[model samples]
Target: MPVLLYVLAVAVFAQGTSEFVLAGLVPGISADLGVSLAEAGYLTSGFAVGMVVGAPLTAAVGRRLAPRWTLSACLAVFVLAHVSGALTDSFGVLLGTRFVAALANAGFLAVALSTATRVVPAGRRARALSVLLGGTTLALIAGVPAGALLGELWGWRSALWAIAGLSAAALVAVGRLTPPRTSTDHPGSARPRLDLRAELRTLRSPDLLRHLGLGALVNGATFCAFTYLAVTVTDGAGLVPSLVPLVLALFGLGAFAGVSVAGRLADTRGRLLLDVAGPALLAGWIAWAALADSPAAVWVLAPVQGALSFAVGSTLIARSMAAAQGAPTMGGAFSTVALNLGALLGPVLGGASLGTAGTAGPLIVSTALVAVAVGLRLVTARRRSGAPAR
Candidate 1:
């Protein structure tokens, strides 16, 4: 991997922190802003909404600019938005800032992923991509916890200030490290360009649609359980409030491990890895739903579930890009969009299930989603292997 890959990861870390730190700060924000917990929760969903909208919009708009310039500009916006979020007095202002910040974040991630694929050798694409995406897992492990600690010590606003500082540093690094446009990674290729019609045309492809759906389902399965993990662990598993952080850390560790394994298998064993991972994910969720009442069972199961959950990131993105045909940047954008869509949908569906079926409801719903995804993959694999479609 190139040094620039790690720099991009740093940018992702800052953005990912801003995206999720709200998870731990909802209570603080609610108290400080004189809002209900549900209102504070909208800060997170608002970011997801921005991500879903901004990915394709930014990809279309920025396609004409050089990747370095586009990425730097996005980071600048990200930094400004974070600072604004820190200084805002009203909950509405904070929500608006989060939305703008997510727009920048989505743009940055799309451009970064496309550039990562361009910079590395074809054989190392998966590893390079993993290195770039690893920032999200690392943020989950370190950034969120750190932000929570900062909020506890100071105030919720302090967390935003810290993220702004981090984003500023990433901006400087991006400006210094990203490659120039003149050295376009694809030899003999035209400058990046996309129009609304072109984007619409690309979306018409069934294969791309399938890949996007797969990405969405894969992510939805993970997040359905994850969105309500803190509540589930406390209420269903009988853990104390203090133990919540431990379970979260365990999940993060598991995600990091999953990304590590994905980097190794994505290139050589894409199908096989998913073949195994998809079912493992289903099994893990089923186990969680069945045994959630047992704290001992949850202690052993959470990390394994977390690990299997994210095992598809690199492979899924690569597959989606393959289906993209000519529009690689848009492909990357759609990948982000699909994941955000799942993130948004997961909580809604999980919340509904919880209301109907109690604490284990989310786990069961997540399991069903993954099972459908796995079934899709099985059918696709069979078709590729010359087996008749049933």
Candidate 2:
């Protein structure tokens, strides 16, 4: 409900754009740097690798600092990295800047996510967190496309400048708006801090690990379809190439809708949302395979599957943070790590099986992954129920 949360979302939008805008710039980068397209593609992978390593590392390193300062510092690093990236002609320098920017992004997101929950009441945590994630969705819809367009028109360096400007603005906003360290968790009580050992124990928790695993599997399934969706739309579904943008936009809109609805329900009705979503997601993928060749089906199903994927994915993130109550920042970091891990692996797995059956292979592979996750959830629940409590 606070404006501060929205400010955090703005910063997220800037970083999220940086995270995705590389896909559009790969060609320009390859030509300008005299590198292969394959090498240019590694810039994106470098960012992902940085996110995975930086999230937990930064969270641990900044644990003693106030959330506001930690966030501001991260944003400063991000802005500087983008600026440096724009100025660099050397491909290696640009790649290093992306990695540095990703590190800052990982740290900011972890702290911001943790900060979002603490600034709100218990019952509103899910909704609050959703607002933060909404920025990422917006990036998918507006920021990435806009950046890509800028690259297309003005060269890729112009897009990097835009990101730097956006990040600089967000950095100023974060510094001005985020709550100071002295704010109390309750009336007449000092703000609570984590015990280092207890935080480590919570990080190692079985419950938290399961939540992370579920998130990773579900995200993997969702992304496997997403990575191949454009080709599927044009080559498999017989749609024209131009319509690919529309289909992708529709998916982004559906994703925003899913996050909005799930945020409202996930706090109290988490189980209900997941219960309904799991089967629907499984069915959604199966049905997509059955109808993947139809143009009409592609138009309708892109958004539907997008909604299902994000609804479950966002809910898992919220629940995972809940499971790590004693260490919110680290939990947030782990959530980032989990989702990125899936984003990385799912495409690899899907690509490996791509030639077997056209678009349907990805659909089938994604379906199998989700099926494994749903079955694992059921099994985990069964074991927990059977176990005798102390």
Clashing residue pairs for model 1: none
Candidate 2 is scored at a TM of 0.95
Of the candidates shown, which would achieve the greatest lDDT relative to the real structure?
2
Number of clashes found in candidate 2: 0
* lDDT of each residue in 1-390, candidate 2, tens digit only: 999999999999999889977888999999998999999998988998888888888888887887889999999999999999999899999999999999999999988888888888889989998999999888878888899899999999999999999888888888888877733242254646765676768867887888789899998988788878877898889899888768877888888888899999999998889888988989988898898898888988889988888888999999888888877557788888898888887877888877887777788888988998888887887788775210
Whole-model Cα lDDT of every candidate shown, in order: 0.83, 0.86
Q: Which stretches of candidate 1 lie above 4 Å from their native place? A: 182-196, 382-390
- Candidate 1 weakest ten by summed lDDT: 182-191
Candidate 2 colliding pairs = none
TM-score of each: 0.95, 0.95
Per-residue alpha-carbon lDDT of candidate 1 for residues 21-114, written as tens digits (9 for 90 to 100): 8988999999988999999999998899999899988977887777889999999999899888888789999999999999999999988888
For candidate 2, give the lDDT.
Answer: 0.86
Candidate 2: where are CA atoms >4 Å away? Answer: 182-192, 386-390
